[model samples]
Target chain A: MSIADNIETESDIGLSRTGKQREFAGSLAMPHDYFVLLKPRVMSLVVFTAFVGLIMAPGNIHPFIALVAISAIAVGAGAAGALNMWYDADIDAIMSRTSNRPIPAGIVAPVSALTFGIFMAFMSVMILGVLVNWLSASLLAFTIFFYVIVYSHWLKRSTPQNIVIGGAAGAFPPVIGWVAVTNSIGIESIILFAIIFVWTPPHFWSLALFRSDDYKKAGIPMMPIVAGNRSTQNQIFGYSIALAIVGVLPWVLGFGGITYAMVSVVFGMAFVYFAFGVLRMSPSDDEMKPAKKLFVFSIIYLFALFATLLGEALWTILL
Target chain B: MDNIVIKVTRVEDERIELNDKQKKARRARNIAIALLLGLLVVVFYFVTVLKFGPVVLERTL
Candidate 1:
């Protein structure tokens, strides 16, 4: 039987037919379901960071090879996303924030998701290995394994530090992209990874601030759910400060140009301001406006930082 | 916020009928898979049997 078979109409639990249909509609969205599995918003960030990494590396890579490498990394990232959704299907079903996901919606079966993830992981790594350098391929493989086994299977739900440690999986894309071009790890890639690693907690904590109830209901140990809102906010502030400091490292390291430095400093200041907002807001404040604002701005901040890096690198090379 | 709760009562087994769009998607997916498998076979042939190797020596020095 498919995973969808386990999903019952509300009538099985004795609800009215229309009510059951409504619930089914909410849970079992089909057709365009695979797109949802990709976590497209997350994919966008991964793709951008990986692109920057590829462009900023010292050596010249063939355009076609770079294209293939980036595509492989994107597939690998998507595979990780699919595996995460598969493993979290049960919790996803219970959380209002995630109940509309493909698996929980009964649009895709759990086993199917598992198969798709494994297939994509192998295809991605293999393609990278054959067409790109082995170093990049190995890194991509490790990233997939870390995301699926270490983070999804083990760390998440087991600890509130899940985002902190699991963030490594997301941070590796740029490094992998860098290695794809230069065939070697560099200080620049390490600095990029560090910025993302520190940036994750504040980004996710802001999300948790607003979605704590969903996490509480799902029995997940997100920071805001495990600790109080105040503690989570404090953690967000600390991580934001760390992220800002790290964001400036690429500029100071001579890997970035003056434009990048100026943009990074400005974005870092904005990040700190948002972080302070999270810290100062009352827990009883309706809608968790500060947390939501910080979450939105955090995304733009990362994109701007990477974009600025790319711009500066191009400028330096051309001028 | 008043949360609305809805339910589904399966008329038959918990099987959902795939709509026309889903059918088209399945067909497209099958074609893509077949093409990929074919490409893999050709790549394997070129790499292992034909030994169509990289011209690194020509490029290096």
Candidate 2:
């Protein structure tokens, strides 16, 4: 339900601009504010992962269909993000990191955002189902449902493992992309899903370490707030080990070539090293450098792993 | 559009006119929506053509 799905992009969705307005007389909301509701940064990652999954799947697809598929997937993710902002407006206002989000900033009304989210969600899923395959569309729908219902609405406040579970919503893009191409699931796409899924807890827990105050203020049960910093650090370390193992699975399973193997092992080690840094943090340090480092590096780590996979696949295809 | 535009009806009523900021914001949003709609039209056309080929337009009434 949150990862910032809790990583970044507290960016939320907006009115079609033609819709009814009330928050401000004449509705001062800019189109950009509406666009922010879509969570563009998060959408970028979803698009990239889904694009890679589509490309890596074992089939040829019409380029237009693939384009539509990716667009739909991205829009669907955005729709979910909009719903998240709509649902989390109260807490969002409390958290400094998210307070300026369009809804909280009074740039967009919550009902308008809700309307925009529902409309886009319906449109994206229907377009994908019609232009692409039902399987992918179903996956997209489920991703939105899981994020909006399971994560944002339910788990986000109820449990420390909110992201551990909600991360599935983020991980589904690639699988949806792969299914958009194959019209079926495959272990390769599953591996891509696994990488993101396993990568999420540590990625977010690092953020939770520093932003615990925000969560505390908002009453969101992020790992650090719920489980305590020490337990969260240990869990991050444990997940780091799991992440390293899972990161290398593509290579182990042989879909990834030597280049991917190298990227995975190197970045994977760096990930663990960072996590271990967080694990070894001292109370004397005024700032949580290790957690911050791990947080920043984790974004790079996931991107590098996925990029290598995308690059290797493209290389294989082009050559 | 001004934030508060006075529309002279038979009764001389005033319609809401956006301020400078709202006018610019509305213009920007309209342009964005127009662009997205234009893109959607193009995408749907291509998808129809690609999916159905030359036969896309061959349907009977």
* TM-score per model over all chains: 0.81, 0.88
**Which CAPRI quality tier does the interface of model 2 achieve?**
incorrect
lDDT of candidate 1 over A107-191, digit per residue (tens):
7777767777889889999989987889999999999999999999999989999999999999999999999999999999999
Interface RMSD of each: 14.0, 22.5
The runs of at least 3 residues in candidate 1 whose Cα sits more than 4 Å from the true structure, single-residue gaps closed, are A1-32, B1-25, B35-61
Docking class of 1: incorrect
Error of 1 at A185 (Å): 1.0
Q: Per-residue error at A247 for model 2, in Å? A: 0.8
- Candidate 1, residue A296: lDDT: 96
For candidate 2, the chain B TM-score comes to 0.64
- TM-score for candidate 1: 0.81
Model 1, span B10-45: residue lDDT tens: 544544456676656666666767877897676555
